[model samples]
Target: MTLLRDLPLSALRALAAAARTGSLTRAADELGVTPGAVGHQLRQLEDRLGVKLVSREGNGIALTRIAEAALPDIDRGFDALASGLRRLRFERRADTFTIAADPSFSSLWLAPRLDRVRAALGRLDVRIVLSIALDSMLEEGIDLAISYRKSSARDLASADLFTERVIPACAPALIGSRSDRDGAGMLDRLPLLHIDQTMGDDVYPTWGNWFTAAGGQRKNIDHGSRFPLTVLAAQAAISGMGALLASELVLREHFRSGQLIEIAREVPALTIRRRLVWPVDGPKARHAAAVAAALAATAIAEADGPWPTKS
Candidate 1:
């Protein structure tokens, strides 16, 4: 409406503030303006709308029926406006850095290594946004992504974070001794917990894939409890549901806490690597690179450490 454009948001805000508090002085205090300024805005609003928006009810102020009717929506509109402003502030703040990654990676990996991340980017505010899309992280105002594919997009650059090797692991109670881990013999005894989610991925180390690589097969290993996420599969494995094959990074804690033990360390890893990906050209690029470098270096340091359970 032409009338909508003719009215100033400041005047509308003044009305909302005054209407909510029923006191122009309190409204002015909330808005950080003089009470006179607030009164002037109310007059301006009335003149523009050609309606009586306010009236005197004793010593306190009262909004007219029309203004009262619109108060709830007006309050909600102001709330929405404030929320949008906050998002913009987060997106463009010079000292703020935003990164996105998948849920499993965020919880299992980045969360544990947050101290290192904060140390790497001194004085900068760090934000990690999680998304289900593992391959693409180029969302609006997101500076960096811990993503699956190296950017085929020309506008981005990436650094190797880690390529995971699907290590076969299970709860220790599932099998008796370390002596049985020499080959895929455990595959025969324990129920194989299948993570069908990664079966199509380049790094998905399924029993079938492992069989292809390590040369072995079990009758029912191919079809047992199937899970979508590594965490769920890890839990199933801990419950002694079956043998789960996952990357060391994802299951490092389970291994450390002795909840899950590697069935065999001799098993090879897959080539499905993850990278710290970011924009090639933007103000965010340099900071993204610094943070990515720090994360990569810290990852290397951590990955080189000893495995808790025996091989």
Candidate 2:
């Protein structure tokens, strides 16, 4: 009896490839090995089986009657093996908790704090999908989602992460001194950085709205280069491209590093609440819950104090 344990998987793979392609060179290419290696594997398989599985017919090789009889079963066995491996790989991927959030939130807020969250979650893989569209977490295979708006879905569980305070900020070089303007006048003289409203939901506060809150004329706020994302606007501000109205939490690192400075005059900062949401009952509910907890803890820590001052 040919013991299954004695059958080498590599030899079988080589035989299957050669049988499927009908050429040693083609099989070698597919297997990413030399033709000689493929031939050696075939020889070893045939030697063990004690049968002539393939014979060289003229310039090419042909499978013998014995090989023809067994090829179908060999192919079926490899197919089953491949299917099993694919399933295992997919299951392993599913173990990773996938989160979806706004592009700016993912890049600026979540990414910087990922190390701490990862340390807390130990052995769990976290995947972040940055997008503006609010997709169904269950249907999209997402473990959790962070959104500016609260989820209205009946099947989802939600938690408040943090409320963002939006403020006017600019590169240190952009401001001459505290006397640059009495208050909101500085914005009119300098280029006002605006976040492009079309990229995300209309709920995003605008430079015009901020100006109005600061008791500045709306006409002075409307003119400036527009950025599609908050991160982009923050980058422009850091580069001294213009003065940007941005979230204090999102640009905390920049403020701490002195790359960007908040304007002295305080406007009524826009307050937007961020929420963590997940399907109430799903395959990854436990994993999502763990991730959500880590995120909430991190959010609280961040809200408690500013980022560490870096020289």
Candidate 3:
């Protein structure tokens, strides 16, 4: 067993270079050292090993039988070292910014608006991971998170992006001329879309809650199909499958395109707060700040616009 402490790296490098090139001058040129230095290093290595590793052959050198036997192992060791260094450099230079978000908010709200973020931070790579688990951000190396939590961890920095208001919405074709009826009566005639509490959050809104808020009975609230994701409920509403209770922020595009109509706007709004969260101390903090600023601007823009009203 040879101790690594006995082998100097400089001597090993010189020996390997000289063995491959077969010339002290060429090895020195490759190593950016003088030919005398290369020769001295090779001699030191031979003395340490107690073996004559090279012999003078014409203008160059030839490896001795013992040196030839060791050459393959030395070459392989250097190649592996070089490969490991390259991988480390590549990993550090990737420059990708990752965000964790709720699936519904990502698909309906943030996904469409990401082009604006890209344009604002040109050349910065952005990745959005949609999940119901807010804790996934911390576990998965996410640089930032769009969270519905009222507070964040002590080690994290957070900015209020926007607050969401839950409201009833349905496809324009589902309404017909029934818009003149009372809120509860109109709600009673339509199948009510419900969002299931599959995200492990006990405080999520329900059709019954919306019905109670609108001064209606809970009879029809539990009759419609249930969906795990709010985006799926919104899509169901767009296809005229049923009327869905969704955040105003998520339904803005649907309203603007006339794909869905806001119903029962007179009902009191249920507010849900959203925030942009990131670690307070990390390599990605600066990049997260820029992304948070862009997201904040988009949120403000959305808030300043007029709420869609029925014509």
Tens digit per residue, CA lDDT, model 3, 1-311: 47575657888898888988999999999999999999998898888879999999999999899999998988888899889987775575457777777777888778888876775455668777754355555555777887776434676788999878878888878776654322556777888888876442446567777777777675645788888887788889999998888788778778888888878766787777778888777777777887889989988986777876556
Write one digit per residue (lDDT tens) for candidate 2, span 1-311: 36596768888888888887889999999999999999999898888889988889765588999988988998899899889987786687666877787778788778787776675455768888754344456656777888776667788888999888777888888878666623666877778888875412467677767767877665655778888888898988899898888778778888888898777464556777778888888666776777788889888876667553422
Q: Which ten residues in a row have the lowest lDDT in candidate 1?
A: 196-205
Candidate 2 lDDT (Cα, 0 to 1): 0.77
Each model's total of backbone clashes: 1, 0, 0
* Local distance difference test values of all predictions, in order: 0.77, 0.77, 0.78
Instruction: State the displacement of the C-alpha of residue 299, model 3, in Å, after optimal TM-score superposition.
Output: 1.8
Error of 2 at 204 (Å): 1.9
User: TM-score of each candidate?
Assistant: 0.63, 0.63, 0.63
Model 3 stretches astray by more than 4 angstroms: 1-94, 118-123, 176-182, 197-202
RMSD (Cα, Å) of candidate 1?
11.8
lDDT of 1: 0.77
The clash number for model 3 is 0
Which structure is stronger by TM-score: 1 or 2?
2
RMSD of each: 11.8, 9.4, 15.5
Order the candidates by lDDT, highest first — what do you get? 3, 2, 1
